[model samples]
Target: MPSISRSTPMRCAATSKRPGCRRSACRAPRRTGSITCGGRTSAANCPTTAARCSPGGAALGEAPDVVFVVADGLSAFAAAKQALPLLSAVRPKLEGWRIGPVVVARQARVALGDEIGELLGARLVAMLIGERPGLSSPDSLGVYLTYAPKVGCHDAQRNCVSNVRPEGLPYDAAAHKLHYLLTHARRLGLTGVGLKDDSDALLPAARTEAERLAAE
Candidate 1:
């Protein structure tokens, strides 16, 4: 798997020695503006956090097709370990899309991606956050994709892909599902409730199983 270099100055809360999550000793970008959490504004300037062009060489000034936000929610370890690998896995699938820099947010909520995406002028935002720790799955990661991300967007306007970890949904499957959602969201011009996850029907294995059941 390809290593994801850290473009932002923000340090990973957890140990950064993971395979794909290597830290890049690059200079920090100039910070400006604050991010709103819940109702109150913070001086931390979370929205303009970090941005880099995709492998496709999109210009920084242009609004990207998709913006990815990685937040260390309940378990920073989950974000530290899983975020980059998942990004690496999914990036090739999004060859033609304009991808914005990976934004790493501290003290972030899933809704925080809206503000970040709005600031970046992204058509879609994908928030990959650490899920609440469970006894058996403390490092589970969850992804939320929203179309036309803005400050006031609600949960009903986003589509979720959860339990993204080796022990759970796994990277490849999660990437496949996310790619499917993104492709359909852009084509259909919407996400959340109106969009359905019928990706399983497109899977070769699923089709084979269905055909066998029908023959039986």
Candidate 2:
């Protein structure tokens, strides 16, 4: 895991068209334990070993409503290809919410978002990470949403949207689900197993179909 200290320069674009949005990149240190990377000992040897941050600038006294972290988990290809498109799809749905910078991390884990969110003083954190590669899907992305993010948060405390790829879950569908989760999590003040994903039921087509079935 990469250590974040106050001394670490967290810089963002001062002239960015999007208010509060800044981009920063960081490199994770090499680990001591033996790890397999293309049969090499160090996982750092992998092509994608740096983490990046693109934060939405916040007012001096105010924290952003949410922070977005894009990590290259097991597949950097997934992050490189899908992160921006997914963000573009979701941003429209998040109108009026304070979104912190977007962080792109190399050799990152999902939990890294917690630390980043804490550092930014955000109300919630969303981590979009690359899933472990599969024989058929080498570039699948996954999304994890955590409320009141902090270090030591258990997996049970987060909600996940997985297999986010063109061949898997379409960006629009994934964004819709994410918007629903973010809105409800803020309102209900929780995530993880406690917050179920029932967004499918709220879709106009789904609802209309269900009503038609009921009328029959």
Candidate 3:
């Protein structure tokens, strides 16, 4: 439901990708900062209290290639781990960008996207987050890229990729989707405004990478 005035981005109703556990597993999630866990409503629901968005939502850095934040799972622990786990791995690729803290609530993620775009002075903001946990795709991940920063902008103004766990979109594929979204977002100067397609490129790259890793 990440849409202000645009098409509603799909928010799959699923929860917890913490291996083969009951749907209720990973429930009662905990969070850091003033954010909330367990439900959609959180401390960030208010605009003022929301964590500072933007690549360097708090700092002004060089025009970054792109600004991104990932919310792994709704649980506070999930979000924290998402940011810290790959700190060393993702740091270099994000050289021109400052990785912001992971945020929950698709709406907040959308807000962060706008904040990043406004702060970076870039055309788009990509917020990669864990999708809502559901029976259809509990472990899936989502990526939301917006053209501009404003409240209630709508979903059509953004682009998204979902079902990002093994049985769904793989990490490599998700990365590729991210790569194309960034490139396309730069080219189109808008995500969801007109005709655009990047799914083919994303799946191939992801599959190839997965196969390559398997060979090793």
- Give Cα-based local distance difference scores for all models: 0.70, 0.67, 0.47
Q: Write the per-residue lDDT of candidate 1 for residues 68-144, one digit (tens) a residue.
A: 88887667789877887788788889988988767766556777787677777889999999999998878889999
Model 1 / residue 111 / CA error / Å: 0.5
The global Cα lDDT (0 to 1) of model 1 is 0.70
* TM-score of model 3 (CA atoms): 0.55
lDDT of 3 by residue, 81-197 (tens): 332222233344444443343333333444555654465455556665666766554555566777655545577787776555555655555556666666666666677756376
Worst 10 contiguous positions by lDDT, candidate 1: 1-10
Positional deviation of 117 in candidate 3, in angstroms? 3.1
**Candidate 1 residue-wise lDDT at 94:** 93
lDDT of 2 by residue, 1-216 (tens): 432222111121111124543433322222111111121122446422222223333222368888787777788788767776788788888879987666555456676677667767889999888899998879888999999987778899999988787777767878888999999999999999999999977776644543454354
Models sorted by lDDT, best on top: 1, 2, 3
**TM-scores for candidates 1 onward, in order:** 0.72, 0.69, 0.55
User: Alpha carbon lDDT of residue 209, candidate 2?
Assistant: 48
Candidate 3: segments with Cα more than 4 A from true spot: 1-57, 72-109, 201-216
Residue 20 local lDDT, model 1: 64
